[model samples]
Target: MNLFNLIKKDQEYWLVDQLKVSHIPNIEYLVAFDKLLTEWKEQRVAYLSLLMDEENEDWLLKRRFKKVSSIVEYTKVLDGSYIASNTFQVEALSDSRVTDSDFATLYDLCRSGSANKNKLFSIRQIMESLERELGANWRDQCFIFSQDSMNYGISIPHIEQDTTDEGRMFYFGVVPEQRCKGYGTKFHAISLELLKTLGAKLYVGSTDTSNKHMRRIFEANGCRLRDIKGIYRIDIEKEFIQ
Candidate 1:
C-alpha cells in the first residue's frame, strides 16, 4: 500500500523501507517491497529493518520479514509526587565510577534476568560500551545492594548533561529471583522520586512487548502508554542479503 524511504543523512539508523498500506494488503505490495529491499541490499545498506504500529491492520503484508523485537513505551509526568527521601539511593556511573574489576561485581548483580537472548549477553560489555557512548554524559545510576542476590539499576538522562534526548529517560530491571517481591514496583516509584528531586519534568521508559511485569511496574508508577512499535529485522547475512 505504501513504501517509505526511511533513511537519514547521517545514516544513524538502518536504511529500510517502511511499508504502510492497509486497504489491500495484497501480495503485489509485498513483492514490490521485496524488490526495494533487494535493490538497497545491492547498495549495501547496514541492515534491513521494518517498523509497524502494533495496531496496524495490514500487518500480514510484510509477514515474510522476521519479527525481531517490539517496544512498548511509556512516559510519566513528574511533579515530584513519587519522590522518596528516606528509601533507595541512586548514584551515577560518572559520579561514583567503578573499576574494571568492580564493574564485574555489578554485572553479576544484574545477571539474574539477563539470559543469552537477542541482546549482547555481557553486562560488563554493555556497561562499558554505554559508558563510552555516553562519555561525559554517562551517569553511574546504580543501587548499592545490601544483599548479594540482586542489584537494581536505573539510567536517567539528565538535562544538564549533553544527553541525546529530552525528558529524564529511566529504566529498571530486577533479578529473576528478586522479581515478584515488589522490587520492580519499588524501583519505579523511587526512580520517579529521584528524577523529581533532580528537577526532571517528565520521565520516559519503554519495555519489550513480552515483558508483562515491567508493563505493570510502569503502570503502577503512574506512567501512561505513549507509543507502541513492532520492529522486524532481516539479518544481513551475505547469503540472505544478496
Candidate 2:
C-alpha cells in the first residue's frame, strides 16, 4: 500500500492533500494521521483535503477534523405551510431520466452574473459541492426536473439536528428562456413536498443577501428567513508571515 502526501504552501496559505492509502487498519495509523494534521494546524495551515479509500476503516476518524472554530453560515429558509392539500408533483432522479438539452437556458436565467460575480459557485464548484454534500445519499433522495424543456434541479442535504426540522436545498440553474413563468415555483414546490414526505419539518436555503429576486421567490413560496451568517476566510500562511 502506498500513501501519498502533497503539501503546498505559499505566502497566503497552506494546502495539505493526503491520498492513495491502501488500507488504514489501526489506531497507530489514525494517531499518526492526527499528528500530521495537528502539525499542519500548528503551522497554521488554512485548508486541508484528505482523499482516502472509501473502504478504509481510518476514514471514520476524518470527522474529527471538522471541529475548526470557523463556521460557514448558510442563509436558512424555513417552510411553515401545512402539507394537507398541496399536490406537489415531485420527480426523483433515475437511471433512465431524460433532461432537457438546454440546461444553459435555465442556468443563464437563474445564475448568470451572480455566479460570475461571487467568484464562487462556478460549474466546477457546484459539481464538487454535489459530490461532497449530496452524492453519498442522493440515490434515495435527490430530485431533478425541467421547466418547459429547460432542466433545473435541487439537492437536499440532511441536517444533523432534528429539532430545527431543517434540511438544505441547493438550486442548480434553471432554464433561461423559461424564466418569469411559474417553472421555478413548480420546481421548488416539488422539492419541498419531497422533503416534507421525508420527514423534513422545515427546509432552509441560502443565497446572497443582495439577491432580491431569489429572496422574493422564497418569500412568495412561504419560506421565511431564520438567520443570517457572515462568510469569512483566513489565510493561515499569510497571517503567519505577517
Candidate 3:
C-alpha cells in the first residue's frame, strides 16, 4: 500500500478535527475532544480531533508524539491559550465605525503568522459561519466592521450577560493585523459605548494570559488583573493505557 494507505490502515492513526469555535480553553479541549470521540466511537476513528477558534492563531505547536507502549503514547500538543477567570469590564468609546478593509488586513496578518497554514476564510465565510452558529439572534448583539466600499469585515459577537455588577459578558476578537495599532482600544471603546447606549453599565473581555500584547492593551485601558487560571492537556492515547 502507498504511504497514505499505510497510514490510513494503522487504525491507530487519528484525524484531529479542529472544530473551529467551541470557546473553551486548552485543558478543556482534551475533555471536549475525548467526549466527542467517545460519543462518536462507532464512527471507527481511533484518534481524537480538537476544535479551536480562528483567533487562536499563535499557539500552534509542532508534532511530537512518542510511543510509550503498544497502546499507550505521549504527545505534547498546542491547544491555543487560556483566559484568566475574572469579571468582565467594559470601556466606553465615542466612535463606532469599523471597515471591511480592516478585516481583510487582519485576516492577511493572521494567515501570514499562522503555523497551520490552513487557508483563511473570506469575509463571507466568516459571516456565514457566525450566522449558522449564532442564528438570527446574532443580529441583535453583533455587528460587522468594515471600511467604506468594502463588503468584508470581522464579526463581533456578544457572550452571555455578565454575572458581575458591570453586566458585560465579553467580546471575542479584533482583526489579527489591526491589533497593537490602537484599533483594539478603539474597538473596545466603541463596543463599550454601544453597550452603554444599550443600558449596559460595564463590559468584560478575556485573553490568554501569555498574550502580553493583549494584556497590555487591557491594562492600558484601565482593566485590572482579576484572576488567573492554569490550562492543562493530556494525550488520551498516552493516558488511557497508562
Candidate 4:
C-alpha cells in the first residue's frame, strides 16, 4: 500500500506520511517514488526533499538525488512536566498584526545560523510561504520570545489538528548575537509550553546530525532520541537555472 502522500509547497514537493516510506516493500515503494518524480517533472516542481531511514539511501542515490544530510528525530511527552522561564515574555506574531518589521526579524532569526546553505528566501518569500502552509491563522502559530524588551528568538509551533495531537516546530532558532547564552534551551522550553496550550499531547522535533547544539538542547529538555533519517534533495530549479 502507498503509505505516503506528495505535498507541494510553492515549487517544492515534500513526501509526507505518518510512518516512514521505507516501511513499505522496496519494489513497491520504488514504483511509487518513480511516479512521484514523473508528477513533479510534469508539474514543473523546483525542488523535492525526502527524509528516509539510512537503509533507503542507496536507492535514492541511484535516482540522482544527493544525500544532503542526516537528521535525528526527538520526542517528548506533554504531561506538563516541562518548565518554562517566567522571566521571558511570549508574544504571538499575530499580535503584531502582520507588520513588515516583525516578519523581517523572523527572517533574520531564521537565517542567523550558517548550517543550512538553502536559506535563500527573501523576507517576502518567507512571509508568503508561511501564510500558504499555515493559512490565515499562521500568524497565531508564530511566536517571538523576549526578556526585558529584547527579542531572543522565534518559534513556529503547530499541532496536527484533527489527525493527531502531535505537535512539531516548523522553525526555531536563537538570534546570532544571542547564541551560546543558554537561550536556545530556554526558548525550546517555552515552545513546549506553547505546544501544550495549542492542544498538543506530544511534541516531536528533528535536527541535522551535525548539529550537536540542538541535539544537546533536546536531551537537556527531557526528550528521548526517537529515530534517525537521511535527507535527500533534488533541486530541479537550480539545475535548470544553471
- What is candidate 4's lDDT per residue for 101-153, written digit by digit as tens? 76676657656764653343566667776767677889898888777777778
Give the TM-scores of the predictions, in the order they appear.
0.63, 0.53, 0.42, 0.85
lDDT (tens digit, per residue) of candidate 3 on 35-139: 654543444544433323323223322222321111111111112221222123331111334344454454444434322312234555555544444456544
Relative to the unseen true structure, what is the C-alpha lDDT of residue 127 in candidate 1, on a scale of 0 to 100? Answer: 60
Evaluate residue 94 in candidate 3 and report its C-alpha lDDT on the 0 to 100 scale: 15
Q: For model 1, what is the C-alpha lDDT against the true structure?
A: 0.56
The C-alpha stretches of model 3 lying farther than 4 A from their native spots are 1-135, 150-177, 197-199, 234-239
Q: How far does residue 23 in candidate 3 sit from its true spot (Å)?
A: 27
lDDT of candidates 1 onward, in order: 0.56, 0.47, 0.39, 0.75
Model 1 earns a TM-score of 0.63
Looking at model 3, residue 24 earns an lDDT score of 43
Give the poorly placed runs of model 2, Cα more than 4 Å off: 1-90, 98-110, 115-122, 147-149, 152-164
Ranking by lDDT: 4, 1, 2, 3
Highest-lDDT candidate: 4
Count backbone clashes in candidate 3: 14
